[model samples]
Target: MTTRTASARYDGMGRTGKGHITTQSGILTDQYYGFNTRFEDEPGTNPEELIAAAHAACFTMALSFALERAGFRDGTLETKAAVKLEQSDGGFTITRSDLVLDASVPGISPDQFAEIAAGAKANCPVSKLLNAEITLEHHLK
Candidate 1:
């Protein structure tokens, strides 16, 4: 098995706290994230944004491999994941993740494409990992 790691440090507490995140790959080094960034629309990255990016990438790659296995050699797939964090009676919770896909695959029937896309959405590692509602909408171009 393979594992990836990331670390975060926070100074202070509550809404005024300032946090920095660093990843094992160093793609994000000391990236800022906190109340302002997460809720106040200030500049910087947040956990939801990172999750969306990971979902999008993971779903797209899964779809590509599924297509290849189905005898498709050339295609393009673009996916966008929207993660929603909602406030409830208890506290805040991640409610759902919506995936939108635009694909261009030569010689692929609409039915086949739909089947493959659905399979990918259901089986992608990220999709399986999330404990939230997941929905996928796809279009063939």
Candidate 2:
């Protein structure tokens, strides 16, 4: 099995209670990484934005795989995944993920494009990670 590891160091005198987020590969990126309620539900960029980025990238890859597998000849494909964070019964939930896709497959019909988009939407890695319900509003144009 393969595992991906990333680490973050809380910046400051270790008392500031906040720090910059980094990946194992030395990628410096910050996510929603602090106490919310203690700071009016806001301090640093939160998990939702990170989740949205992950989902968008993952879903795009999935769509690419599906397209190649379907013998679409690997055309240009782009996806915009919108992960909606909403207030729920207790905490916030990612209530919806809208995948807007645009592809240029010369021989594939619109129905086939939609099918591939749908499949990718259902099987994306980020989609699998979330415990909340997912509502995919996909448009393969």
Candidate 3:
């Protein structure tokens, strides 16, 4: 079997803790302000944040493709993915993923929006990347 390696890096400057997330090219992030739970930590960006970003971007791109295929014109797409982390008997694991989508496209109703969001959530590459289970609790508000 061939092993593929992907890299993400970070440098820390003691914003409040001892670590910061460095990009793959070696750039440190400002801070990790979570949209869920509002737990502000001075430490490096946690796994959940990275997962959320991946899921959001992936779902947005997939949703865009779906909209285009459905004859919808280009428009802004905003997405949020919340990753819930929990402790298990053996160790920690990702329990659930909740996604919220908002798009500014004409001629698309709430029902259509829901369908598109569901499609994206199921087919997004990031969603497929995880071995853990994911849930698409979407709200098109």
CA lDDT of each prediction against the hidden true structure: 0.96, 0.69, 0.70
TM-score of 2: 0.74
Query: What local lDDT score does residue 59 receive in model 3, on the 0 to 100 scale?
Result: 88
Deviation in angstroms for 83 in model 2?
1.7
**Runs in model 3 with CA error above 4 Å?**
1-5, 8-40, 137-141
TM-score of predicted structure 3: 0.70
lDDT by residue (18-132, candidate 2, tens digit) is: 7556666665455436545123556665456667777888888888888889887657777676667777898866777766666777788888887877788788878888776
Model 1 poorest ten-residue lDDT run:
88-97
RMSD of 3: 5.6
Clashing pairs in 2: 11-19, 32-45, 32-46
lDDT by residue (tens digit), candidate 3, 1-141 = 745333433444333333334454344444433222124544446668778988888888998999899898857888888888887998677877777776787878889878887887789888888777766654443
Q: Pick the candidate with the highest lDDT.
A: 1
Stretches of candidate 2 exceeding 4 Å from the true structure: 9-17, 29-44, 137-141
Candidate 3: deviation at residue 100, Å? Answer: 1.3
TM-score of each: 0.98, 0.74, 0.70
In the range 35-125, model 1's lDDT, one tens digit per residue, is: 9999988999999999999999999999999999999999899999999999999899888999999999999999999999999999999
Off by over 4 Å in 1: none
